[model samples]
Target: SDYSQEPPRHPSLLINSKVPFNAEPPRSALASSYVTPVDLFYKRNHGPIPVVDDIERYCVDICSLIGTPKKLYMRDVRMLPKYNVTATLQCAGNRRTAMSKTRKVRGVGWDVSAIGNAVWGGAKLADVLELIGIPKLTCSTQSGGKHVEFVSIDKCKEENGGPYKASIRLSQATNPEADVLLAYEMNGKPLNRDHGYPLRVIVPGVIGARSVKWLDSINIIAEECQGFFMQKDYKMFPPSVDWDNINWSTRRPQMDFPVQSVICSLEDVQSIKPGKVTISGYAVSGGGRGIERVDVSIDGGKTWLEASRSQKTGVPYIADHVSSDKWAWVLFEVTVDIPYSTEIVAKAVDSAANVQPENVQDIWNLRGILNTSWHRVQVRVGQ
Candidate 1:
């Protein structure tokens, strides 16, 4: 079936794009306070969504700058013990909308929901790398060598180009703590076409684009993949850079994502009964630091309070659940006594002591990449 044509509808967020992919539902749509359902998770695709059949026929090829190429068919790959992990896959451009507000940038205009956590089931990439002859290096030395590149079979009608490919540093590829995987299944079921049917790379702590879907090739290289996506796109630029003055080659690709968080509840102009109202959301830091805490402020950063991050105790509106690998996400909440007031604001921090930047202008780039800033929602307190 062409699942891409009939993408699943999600209730909790607003849809920003529909053809190439679907953005998250608006924060106001998150009625429930826990993990987002699999079907409802935001879908982001850059090309024609691929359809895969005959699992036995599926094959993944591994190559290197210095070694012989190796190929693994579906059966061969599945022979290895399967490992399951719940991880959050977030697009690098999750908050482009906020950045776009400061100045028009290129690419899909995503709101806060471009991220979703799911239980991924598959053979670990580390195991596959070992099978293909990656030497066992100490944890500290893993990042020392080169880069591990990934290519997708899913094709896009390039205005003028070849297939899509992306990669990450070898250090990131080999980190056991990163939990990179060749995910064949998502949320306990076979992957949907929109999400990469037969397989996709799941690089837990890197930008989502680096986790290429319809994964076909894995290469170990001494440098980042020189593909257009890596060489020319997804890079950060000074706030002073603009479309006309930009030099793409001078900037580096966004390999690791920055710490980011968002307020997923309450919408601008929404009204709530006066009294105690709870604010809740998710926070995560890329590159495997994990989120340590999320602070919430009701008065627009005038003061801050630690949002509850415990898994126990019924904190209404707070979703404190997290996955085992801690690669998924941290749901947090803070209850505030609202007098008949005018507006409310909230923000979060991660384990790296990285707090979301206060505004979009400071981090604006020509491509609108890496937009993690304080997410604020204005609401009215009713009498």
Candidate 2:
């Protein structure tokens, strides 16, 4: 009955804990202008939290290896037509504390706030897999299928193992730029219960344990996602492989999640009120290919400025104004003029040139998974 004591009302920034696989450190860690305030936006559970009683007896089982198994509910999926997505869910171990400082790797040691950027409304997992009929199999330009598997109702055991299941693929569950959702709501309302209330599965740009929460089943598979958190823990070895010369089948399960950025308004020991110090953060890139620019370095990367972005309404490439994937957050800013004894550092760079990995021991891996580097915070100027 330990639902992690269920109490994340809102405004969160915890980041890591292990009892039930916790994590939540990325609303940019709430600073740099803040806006991930959906109950602190970082809860990556793996087990024990399923207490769903009734969203009118919520269901959601739409299976398909070839087909058969339909189950709708939740008012037959909210009577369709409701697609609102303001993406960003990052957590391929979102910067696992820079790969646990290059070593000790296993799970849930996150430090980039596990990432968050809400606006996710609901309905549109390809219109509920074409209204649960599920048949859309085409793209055989010569048989080359590989992913599309999401199965979660939040069950677990492993460590002497038994239950736990997770999956993702089928070109990121049929990419329409990977909108892939079944979300009941978040940043709008409803899904609270440690965030898998009646439904969950947001898969934007992949990773975040394949975006599966209480969601029951969704398979379009060809392979990949055999479970065990996708073929034996989020694969990525090298840094001279550890955990017994790791070779978990030629390592590879971490679908798209590279260019990242963070530095959510200074705080290592915060205290700045001298002249000017207005740095900001939040940048993303993974499959969708949007975040075109976010470069801001304070004397650490030598010299880099250009950071003033924000524009996600109607998205027409910033539409003479709003264009960067609607549902917001590309936010950037800069304003420096420090003196009262310095020690500030910040870093970010996106838009596919994909910067960030400058440290973290050359992309440390052994299951710590893709920890986008450069996110230092240590300010002090006051007086």
Worst 10 residues of 1 by lDDT: 315-324
Model 1 C-alpha lDDT per residue in residues 57-95, reported as the tens digit of each score: 788889865557899887776887798877777888888
Residue-wise C-alpha lDDT for candidate 2, range 1-383, written one tens digit per residue:
25555554443456366557486654445544335767677787766777777667668777665546788787767787777787777778776756786577777776666777787788867667766454344332133445556666666765233334556655445545457778888878877877777778777766667777777766665666577777778777778888877777887677767777776776555777678778876777676666666666656666767777664433334412134563234766688786774544545544445666767778787778777777666666767
Residue 275 lDDT, candidate 2, scale 0-100: 88
What would the TM-scores of all predictions be? 0.88, 0.33
Best by lDDT: 1
Query: Using TM-score as the measure, which candidate wins?
Result: 1
Clash list (residue pairs), candidate 1: 12-29, 13-25, 13-26, 14-25, 14-26, 143-171
lDDT of each: 0.73, 0.66
